[model samples]
Target: MSSGGYKPVVNTVRHSITTVSKRKRSSISEPSNNHEPVVVHRPHTSLAPPGSSRKPSKSSRRRRRVRKERSSSSVDRQWVFSASNFRNLKDKLVLVSYNLLGVDNASNHMDLYYNILPQHLDWSRRKHLICKEISRYNATILCLQEVDRFDDLDSLLKNRGFQGVHKRRTGEASDGCSIFWKEKLFKLLHHEEIEFDRFGMRNNVAQLCVLEMNCEDPESKLCMQSSEQTCTSPRRLVVGNIHVLFNPKRGDIKLGQVRLLLEKAYKLSQEWGNIPVAIAGDLNSTPNSAIYDFVASADLDTRLHDRRQISGQSELDTKRSPFRNQHAVSASQTNEWSQEELQLATGGQATTHVRHQLMLNSAYAGVPGTLRTRDQCGEPLATTCHSRFQGTVDYIWHTKELVPVRVLETLPTDVLRRTGGLPSEKWGSDHLAIACELAFMGEGC
Candidate 1:
């Protein structure tokens, strides 16, 4: 998109898509069925050198929430909430999930924090605010990825009457998935987690957990063979949480991991009475990719198994390294996207929607005709904002049987850009957390 003509469009509806990041960063593909596709491109390399001489203003500095070095004792701090203090979980079920980035002190993009956005650099403050954001939602379940400090997170929420399950990447110090739920409202019936250390790839993991909801009334209108109160079986839900591999070059691996996850979930669901399910994660795959659609696909084979592999072919390159080879850049992310890629990426939102139509549906898919660009929080849909990658990579999807009620409030694009894409003074995490409320189709309050 050209600066002379392109602009981000904000849908008036609450569940509107705040698409097009303008000049601040990142491009998106708007695929259409008949006409040529519209493409929004991402900023590949740094545009300017650091320290150009101008200093930041007070208001700009004030906008940031800073935390000075304090006692390390807060890490040891713990709180315990009484049973009466817990939120009512039966009436509403909100799930919030985020890629907390990580606890690594030295990262490739870490320099950008000090050199460019100095005011937005505070790891201690960022951690606190990330926990605060998670608490504010008071969601029924919290699925967190890129959680290096699982112990700290577990400790933080433990006092709030929440229990967590963590699975670290094999042979890595950090980088893992953590799933937390209110102890009083849910009981873990079964758990299956996989570490995708296959295909000579870096470690990535997916976790599936079956939770039985603790209903106050035995007859709390559960979904079973009979809609009667005769069955004493508790209501159940299956949740899939993942931190998908990030190499655009190894899309094959990403697709395979997703397919394995879906297949596992399907088999587990079938063995467990075909329970309702919800999947939350940092997929790395864009909304238009075939893998994104395949998550909800009931009968689709893995992209690796398909004889005629389609979708994302605009990006299939033999020269591309198995990993993100800086020496071998993917033209789609760095340079001008080809017309065919644009047609795949920028085709009108409707065309992608039609292709993405699946057995399961996104909680925030919204009505027909609109693209699946709305975040679970109903804010600007972009989940990630960084110098390298800025787009919606996080999602909350539920089976069609679980009707979506509403999405939580998320950070607006204007506010998000102010901090220059996450790890901001306002919110923690480079990847924005997303949440939505869901209810059983036939169950009424």
Candidate 2:
């Protein structure tokens, strides 16, 4: 582990990421097996200077690409979309997230070498391309994971009219999380890093930024309801950029990481006057995995025990059912759980002091049925496409206070199938970006 991966506190000044040599490989804490994270990608050997005269022959390049692509028969569909499902888009805030699959200077592991993706050879060009694509959305907020070069990316984003907040993993990994929002559209009120390495792992973290949104229409802002009098309150949102541990073998570690982030999120909402919240990042957990259930579902202690095993089947049912549970977890029910159950339900967990009255849901849940993918994991969306696993691992989750008005589909399945898992000719990384347009459900501007 190198000190190069560690970063400064949440700062307001815009900065660029400084490049380092291949001696630093890091990410959500490791070394003691205190946490588990899904595998990420980076270059195997040091890349040569960009302007070298030598070039591989077309045939040799093709052979290398073919070897890198592996199999694609299983990746028939990319994401679901229906042109006919029209949306009444108005007064909406668009949000997007992506995992760049970047390795810290030397963070990426896998002694068994694989062919390098498009960006592996030239990081500058990759940054330019990825930044260009991300800028096209002009989203209200953008969350990025595995950001090995934080200052560079943050400076790039700031120059594009967005201000960003970033935090590097404290432990082994150099790659961390960075979140940016339109400087003119929102004001950063408070920020901090929620560290989950309390068990001694320094890798996993959720960088929390509380932003007060600027609204043109006073009519659209939320109101403080009171028995005697009422007043208008600034509309705000809690945004988080987090990368979970990657070890698929340890579901418990994933749960612990998520719990730490969400608990902080829940607390921040209260500190920020209980504002609407939206979280985006690479969770590393699949939709059907126990970790997903721990996130998408509320009251995991009771629900999990009732099922007898850690199951994600209910998450699919809720997402598909005509009547999605829009209601928040009732306080009465939350109060019934004992302290022991709250602290050790799934063996040894943290205690979350209940949740906000508003319910949280994945923004993609609002997509019309006809426009969504039908796959084994419930949705036909595949966010991350590494050689070993290719399914959705990136997400944008929000409180019910905000409604999803529209969502952007990932790269077409055909394009993904041809490119194989990632670093395709069309997309920059293995994980495709996800975006959603959300509107305030409480008022009309």
Candidate 3:
């Protein structure tokens, strides 16, 4: 027989099966005569109770009704606080970003150095400090860059009672970005890691998270002391976390990478349909750099412009505000200050500095009252002389669909000590984590 003719005959025999149960017996029988096998169909009705109606019972009807109601209720609840519901998120969501300097394994004295480490000091310890700082602000979403491995971060958040979704490493610097959320509040739908060659270095872009906020009803009224109900604003928002390359040697390279990152984010936004996005991260370059322009020009519309409001310097008059020359300061000056110096001098407040060049080129400059800082913990050391000249290197940008209710930098003392400390054998990473909280106006993002 030809191959095709024999193939179908073999398949017909292979599909035959026979089973005998209390209620029924099923089988495929073949005739002794050299003819094709036949498939017989039979269904026993003995399983039915005596006099039972073939139609469903009243209780089954009730169950079906309840199941439908439950399914609809779940969808309504989800839609009630979708990304579109929240037009402004000043106090609803918080986003954080930090660089975890890769782990150093060169030390030979593993016993003394590694053993004394706190149980939490492992990846979990560092992630705990970060999550703890984030929890302080009640952050809903967090973005971390330069993660050594996905496992290290998973272990950290797992230990802290938090869950995270991360992308696989692509190239050199197996370094990647990840996002963690309060699982009780948000659900992750999709995640992917993107890599592109820029200049000569290989850079990575991680796009992860589809968040849903457990928001309060904006139209719902709160009962007043007099028994009358007053309307309250909506709560809940959606956000995106990103980490762009910072290496200045390859401006063109970084610019291209930024373009690719924005492309991916824009595609996600379209796929999500009407969902607002907040992109946060340690963009290696400040807002003034071309890379920032590339991101700002993407489908994302900047809801808040750059602002310089000094913290801890409340005692200092407006004339002494370190943020005064925020626009005038050069990239060189911003780089000269250490994270510790910026934290101490700002009185635990951090600044967001954009490129003066972009301000000069665009009409979006001079958005007043937009710039602000939050308090950092711990007292300044007397030996450290004066606080560092601080400016905004980190950032929080939002879409027009979402409004900014409150955006501030978070710098807890313990986090500062861990991130600002010089590269040491004990610490898991460098760079203080910056966090922000935003409130929604109508529906949750």
Candidate 4:
């Protein structure tokens, strides 16, 4: 499929997904409403150097709450709220997931961002805006995707007490994923990178890191070593970062990439004494999608779905296209998988289903969504918005060992519409940043 094509338009109303950890599933009507497809064109890449001559003023910083009077100023004042009801918990850990729009990608895909102001597209200004937004969170862990300018980001974050590792994509793609942590908070024990092309999937990549907290207090150490432990063994966590493929037509590859990521997360968790795990990034799949179902349920019968519709992106184009008919045709055809794809995606024979061992849950689960900000699923109404598309594709999923305390708020659709799409003069990326505060179970959570 060409990189340039009409982008599918997602419906506004969506059903919420139940917590997969409880082995529950929620069913909803198949996508029946669709808007006109947005036309997109391929444009030449702009290879501009980083512009960092000027600095932003104090007023340029973001405000915690959104204001009714919107402006073209660099400061972002979007409404922010905790997921569901807010709770004050002790020893809470904050994790943030963001996809920093890559400099090269921004230039190459200018057509999709035509509605955005040109000044907002400048790498220099955007870099400052991105850093300022991140500083406000003061997150202990950050899982970032589409980070092409690692050195610049690292330098900015390093001063804020964060040390990070970056992994570039396997092919010509300039960006990949990065995992950063505050130096005083955690010690990195193990790190690994995943290049999906090696597994015959694609050029996309993922990062896994095992972090152990610093126990500086002598009394805390004694408590951990004592026969009566205060909490779980060793303050440790396993974090996974990934940027799944965006090609909606290649659901086979998407499933395979995610499967490998989960497998790796489980392996690392076991190796590190089955510690708590947090996986964050842009999965490029929507809530309640077949791929999402498999992620939540840890099992999927591939035969039940059409390979192309597995990600649910095709459903967004149902109005103008014959997606329903195509789905039926694809489902009836036999042998949809090649031996390589079958093994990579399902980790077994082409005729079998896919399953994973780790019991995972979305951090946003159990929270209620308002009509303007999220679906009943408690997921953001739209995490990414641009000229061609607007929908929720980013998430932070966690294992049962941790309990969610609060989650960062996502912007309402009306706010995004007012901005004329993202990477605007205010916000730095097309996607909104998601964050969650979590505490280890049985540790005063």
Candidate 5:
């Protein structure tokens, strides 16, 4: 497979498998509430006649049943608590994005400390700490970018109670992407890698897992058996995690990349039918930029909430109503507006609801100091740009079918260095991490 730049061969194979899997999985599951029979086809046998001798051996049958029982047992254990409750539904699904800085390579470093332990420590502490925080949310799936190699990432996550599948090859200069999940929550059915152009970078796109959600009511068993509800069976959901090119700063190139990503996602959504889809990464573009516009236009939801609006509303209305002047004006002039109306207009948007903002630098600066302190926790700060435009470029987007329950930006910190007695300025990576909570429409897609 091509590493840094695009390779047509890799793209073709990955796209083909993704398409085939989508069709096959849809065929196996029943249609949604719409009653549109979307059937995914499986491998069929070519027969010499109607009753040709092609029966499976007794040993093969036994193995198949044993495998099925093992797989079912694993899934059942993951949801046994919910099975016992039978009245409470799981509320949220979380997704996280982290950039694992370039892996430690001998050629890149000359000093022993920086060469041997720095890279290894950064990988072990920084990356795994980030992973631990993500796991706290009980995220069903995670999309990670800028991973050095499949083995390193897999080893790290596997050690931390998570299972992952890496789609890229090793020894390549630029790192590829990966998806890690709780083994109990998702089953890996298929995966592939896609390249953007004939000479562009090779990217990964995988149908990594299917999450089975437990039903709340015991009587609901009959509902699933009857197949009357659209999402009767708790099945799999499709997740596409990717990292696009950072150079060639032209709008058209970035827009084209966004289009390609969305096209792939749309195809998967069609094949997966009613399964909510999410695409997350460092798109390297701001929310107002054309690249972001192209992505938003594709109908895939993004987690870019406006921080300015969120903070302004929270401070002015929720706490103390910044509209005292408006209230006074209304009282003196006998205006038709009430205190609530004045507050609504002067305080900005409503405070009860916090919309998704593009967590940019400007937004971060505007956040209350207390909250900022809580987010940072006494770490040395690193700028996004060397001197200018230091803000959030990373983001998480979701499909309309999914609702964002909560979103947070993992603060950059020198905890690794400080705890290790190293300089406080040292950081694991250049970009901040973005995380979000999503409510799946049905049990599982």
Candidate 6:
């Protein structure tokens, strides 16, 4: 493919990586798809021209904006806030979730990205871009999927004062889930690696970690934890990272993997005095799909869904729960096999109803965003864009203990279309990174 959609920008100065930055920037425009374009109103700045000494007047700035708008429209991929609580909030943290398309996988799946330019898919070049894109966020915590190049990422992020743990997927999949955190802010208290293959959920895996805040009280300024013997640790949070299976046909396996991860996360939370929990990754399930509904609502009746179309990735199945699994099985020729699949998905409890106690909320859904970039539920219209499919499958979900202050919005579909697909010169992967600033909720509020 040609590099016709490539968009380049001036590189910014590198800053110390110890502290996460909350700065925002305007994103370049893309080729138009069938979706409507979002026009953002950029805030007027007093920044003087290159070598000019004096700041331009209001009228001149207005003229400049008019010319820029006429030349091209752009989307603001910045952190959006509903309120100013974050300004006064203490112990605030920024979390980012991304799926860095693995090098080996990318090469093996060239047919899936035939429309992408050869240079854009080059691992050597893409790796640098990936690091730079991630560095821009300076997130306090990162939940990454398809990270086969953990050593490279570790070296790059280590300079930023981040410590990470990697759990490679079982079987032949080279990519795995990795969780990285700012060492200055959080200390690793406990961690667990889960391989779903053991539970008949295939070779997918998940990573869980209990991160303890390195400070004393929430009211006091953050201080390094004392080395002396301390009976109790400070406030903490449970971080769960997973890349759910991508096979849309195996909804039963998908649900089983998610269920196991959540179960593990809940157990870890209880062991740590019920700390807040945040789960992030590429779930491979669209918003409002049966799997998504199960995660958000914490209950799902397996009998109401079809095992083959549980993730809602199939266009033929629009209803979250179209029909009873038994009826669908009986209607089809694979009655006995489908029956066992239902039991496997439901944990063989002879019950269709499944529930969880996490009470989690999606960060993007909790925060309001522009109509251009967000859906009715406030989720990015498309997190992953490629030649075959372009839709949302990545998310950052958290418990009630953490409240979303601001979220890093994704590019609009129109903007993405300009690139003809993903893994463009501007983006290192097919999926856009999603991030959010979360604050610990106060006792009363």
Off by over 4 Å in 5: 1-91, 104-125, 169-174, 199-231, 299-389, 410-427, 442-445
lDDT of candidate 6 vs native? Answer: 0.74
Model 1, global lDDT: 0.57
lDDT per residue for candidate 5 within 1-445, as digits (tens), equals: 0011111111111110112231122233544686543545777645458877776668855544333322222210011011112233244556776655445432253231331234433555566555555556566567777676667567767776567866553334456678887654455654645565432333323223334443433332212333454544555455666665554223233434555555556566566664656667656554434344344443321123221221111112324421121111112322133333223222323332112211111122211222221223111122222111233345566654555443443332222111221111233454545555555545442
Return the TM-score for each candidate structure.
0.64, 0.66, 0.48, 0.76, 0.50, 0.76
Per-residue lDDT of 83 in model 5? 10
Badly placed stretches (over 4 Å) of model 2 are 1-90, 105-107, 110-113, 117-121, 199-202, 216-231, 301-358, 369-380
Higher-lDDT candidate of 3 and 5: 5
What local lDDT does model 6 show for residue 190? 92
Q: What range of 10 consecutive residues in model 5 has the weakest lDDT sum?
A: 75-84
Query: Model 4 lDDT vs. the true structure?
Result: 0.72
Which residue ranges in model 3 land beyond 4 Å of their true spot? 1-91, 104-128, 159-161, 197-201, 214-239, 297-392, 410-429, 443-445
Q: For residues 1-445, write the lDDT of model 1, one tens digit per residue.
A: 1011112224422322323332334343555675443655666444347755454557634433221111111111111111121232334466888888786732645743442245444556667777887777767788999888888888878877789899988875467999998887778999988877653335888899998776653443223234354436556778889988766655555655665676677677778887788888988765555566566454433322221222232233345432111222333443333333323332332322112222466654532111223433222346766544445667777775565555553444444443444565465667777776666653432
Name the better of 1 and 5 by lDDT: 1
The clash count of every prediction, one per candidate, is 13, 25, 29, 0, 21, 2
Per residue, candidate 6 scores C-alpha lDDT tens digits across 400-426 of 888788888787676666566668766
Model 3 TM-score on a 0 to 1 scale = 0.48
Task: By TM-score, rank the candidates, best first.
Answer: 6, 4, 2, 1, 5, 3
Ranking by lDDT: 6, 4, 2, 1, 5, 3
Residue-level lDDT tens digits of model 2 in 292-355: 5556665454443322123222122323422121212333432244444344333345543222
Give every collision pair in model 4.
Answer: none
State the weakest 10-residue window (summed lDDT) of model 6: 1-10
lDDT of each residue in 108-174, candidate 3, tens digit only: 2233233122332355455555545555555556777666666866765666545786653465555
How much lDDT does each candidate structure score?
0.57, 0.57, 0.40, 0.72, 0.41, 0.74
